[model samples]
Target chain A: MQHEREHTLKAFDQDLDRLRALISEMGGLAEHAIGEAMRCLVERDVAGARRIVQDDKKLDALEIETERRVVQLIALRAPMAGDLRDSVAALKISGVVERIGDYAKNIARRVPELQDVGHLEPLSLLPEMARIATHMVHDVLDAFVNRDAEAAVKVAERDQALDDFYDSIFRTLLTFMMEKPNNISHATQLLFVAKNLERVGDHATNIAEMVYYAATGGQMTERLEKAGAL
Target chain B: MQHEREHTLKAFDQDLDRLRALISEMGGLAEHAIGEAMRCLVERDVAGARRIVQDDKKLDALEIETERRVVQLIALRAPMAGDLRDSVAALKISGVVERIGDYAKNIARRVPELQDVGHLEPLSLLPEMARIATHMVHDVLDAFVNRDAEAAVKVAERDQALDDFYDSIFRTLLTFMMEKPNNISHATQLLFVAKNLERVGDHATNIAEMVYYAATGGQMTERLEKAGAL
Candidate 1:
């Protein structure tokens, strides 16, 4: 009986390890999608943008598979407490990562429209913001894999910098649109691209919160709020 | 032994019912929050907007409780297959609904910022778009409660109209900002407001997809895409 129990436990551990690996793989794909989408914008690579849009389907499929594994693990193992939280967190994080991929795809879709418009000053900020957002996605997923609450807390703190970048870009875009009425069309699209990056940052923060909860079984909001106040 | 099994089944049913009730309650609160936020924006009710921001905490608390209940139920019951899907769906839906509440709060927070700027033409459409988005939220939750895949599919279809409204408003705001450079600041804020409403519509669609999946044990993306193509 003890040997049988050990076998089941080993299987459960493998199931969890597999789930984490799936999330890491999905995260890598999402990060690549964001990078490629931004590259499409920077290099004016319409074909590359289209490819990112097409690639989002793979992330979607992975999310479905990850969710299936989560449900199966929960049902088969009946994980309690921290273990259950880990499974649920993986499920939620996969959904968030898929959304980040969608945002990347959305950004990519805007590239073809912007091709005809002349470059504006604020256009330069897009890639920088995308870089920061992608980095957050990377670090937060790593935190999840490591079960590092401190790293997750640090990731949450970094969102403010992204917000600041967005604010500066918003001001610059407004000035550009105000100076040249014709700049309004492309400027607004850039505004959306910036907003999408900002949202990616927010999703990263959400994942951090989930990771914090999974690690400590305690709410992260209070600590985040206190950190914000500081 | 049979009697014990029956008792366990009864408890599981009650637990699921309780989860549904909590979700319904949270959904109602979120709907109220959205309405109040829109009302604040339309009426320039700063106090009311402040109230919506504060009230978002309630939704947050409910989400935590719902998650805890879900973890407990999963651990205790080891629900398999369809039953596990139901629990997971509830879990995912709670997070989505909470986010809808956050978007409402975000809109409300913008009200104070908009107070110093004069109204633009597109500002008039904000409340109308919000109404549609909130209605989608309501109907989607109802679909979940009733296990109505048809209703969920219908809710998903309605998001297109919301997207249309947003596109029209976006163009109008761009025109207003271009016609007078001074209109840029207020117009940009209105643009954000409209985008937030559009996102609420998206969240509603997310819920509809989850509800449809829970009801049919099949993905809704293909159907949604076909509908989009039509």
Candidate 2:
């Protein structure tokens, strides 16, 4: 019986490791999807946009598969306290990943709509925004694996920068719309894409916040601006 | 041991019943918040706005308390299968409730601005939108407690009406702003408030969809569009 208990513990560890790997894999696909979607926007790469849409299929499949594995672990093993938290975190992580997939897909769909806007005036900082979001996802996943609360805190802090970027985009788009009403249709589509990307960043921040809670057993509810350091 | 098992089962049932009741209470609070918020918008009721803002603290505390109880359940009972799903669902419901709280706050914050417009027209359907959302939450919570997949399905189907309402508000506000630019500030703020209310309805729809999956063990991805059809 003792040997059986030890084996179950080993299996539990293996399952959790695999789950984390699956989440990161899904995160990679979503990050790539966001990158390609924005690239399609910048370069008018319709084919790239098509690729992001197609790749969402795999993300969707993996989300379902990961959720099932988590469910199976619960029903099959009756997970204890910490394992329950871990499994619940996996479920929430899968949700955030799937939503990131949707954001990328939304950006991809808006690519064709922006074709007449004459190259989108470069959107100067949005790529940086996407990079920050991608890095947050990657860092949060690593932090989750290592139980690194400080890393999670750093990721959470970056949300203020993301917000600054979002506000800049809003101000810029509002000016573009007001100054050149003719550009409203094209510019509005771009605004939606940017907003979607920003929301993706928000989701990453949410995951990092969850990591903070999981790692430190403390809820980090204070605003990043109030906290002041990354 | 059998008596002990019976006692444990009874205690679990009591917790489940309490959780269901608390969610219903939170839902009612959120629904009232939404209604009063719209009243503030239409009537420019500063007092109503103040009331909504004050009540938001209650919703926030309810969410925190709900989460604490759900997490405590995980620590105390290594729940499996349906019990596990219910606990996780409780957590998810708290997320939706918090978001609803935010929309209410947005609506309340806009009251001082709405007073500036003085008899704006788009306020007509704004309350309807909030009402539909509040109804969806109540219906979904009922479905969850009763395991009524059909009720969940019905609520899921009505999602588009809310979106359609959103689109209507958008067009009305944009047209109003263009034709009567004096109302731009108020109209724009109301536009955002309407959008936030619409989003609350969407989250409620998401919860209804989750309840459907929980009750029926069906895949949710394929049904998002169909789920919009009440």
C-alpha lDDT (0 to 100) for residue B45 of candidate 1: 88
**CAPRI classification of candidate 1:** medium
- Could you give me the TM-score of model 2 versus the true structure? 0.83
B-chain TM-score, candidate 2: 0.92
Best by lDDT: 1
Summarize candidate 1's per-residue lDDT along A16-41 as a digit string, tens digits.
88999999999999999999998889
Which ranges in model 2 have alpha carbons more than 4 Å from their true place? A1-6, A44-54, A71-84, A122-125, A221-230, B1-8, B43-61, B64-87, B106-120, B177-188, B220-230
Residue B5 shift from truth in candidate 1, angstroms:
3.9
Candidate 1: segments with Cα more than 4 A from true spot: A221-229, B1-3, B222-230
**What lDDT tens digits, residue by residue, belong to model 1 across residues B118-179?**
55567778888888999999999999988899899999889999999999998888888878
Q: lDDT (CA) for every model shown?
A: 0.89, 0.77
Candidate 1 lDDT (Cα, whole model)? 0.89
C-alpha DockQ for predicted model 2: 0.22
lDDT by residue (tens digit), candidate 2, A1-230: 99999999889889988999999899889888888887888888888888888889899889878877876766566676667667767877887888789889988988777665575562656777788877877787788777777787778778778878877887786666566556655665666676677777778878887776766556667534467642
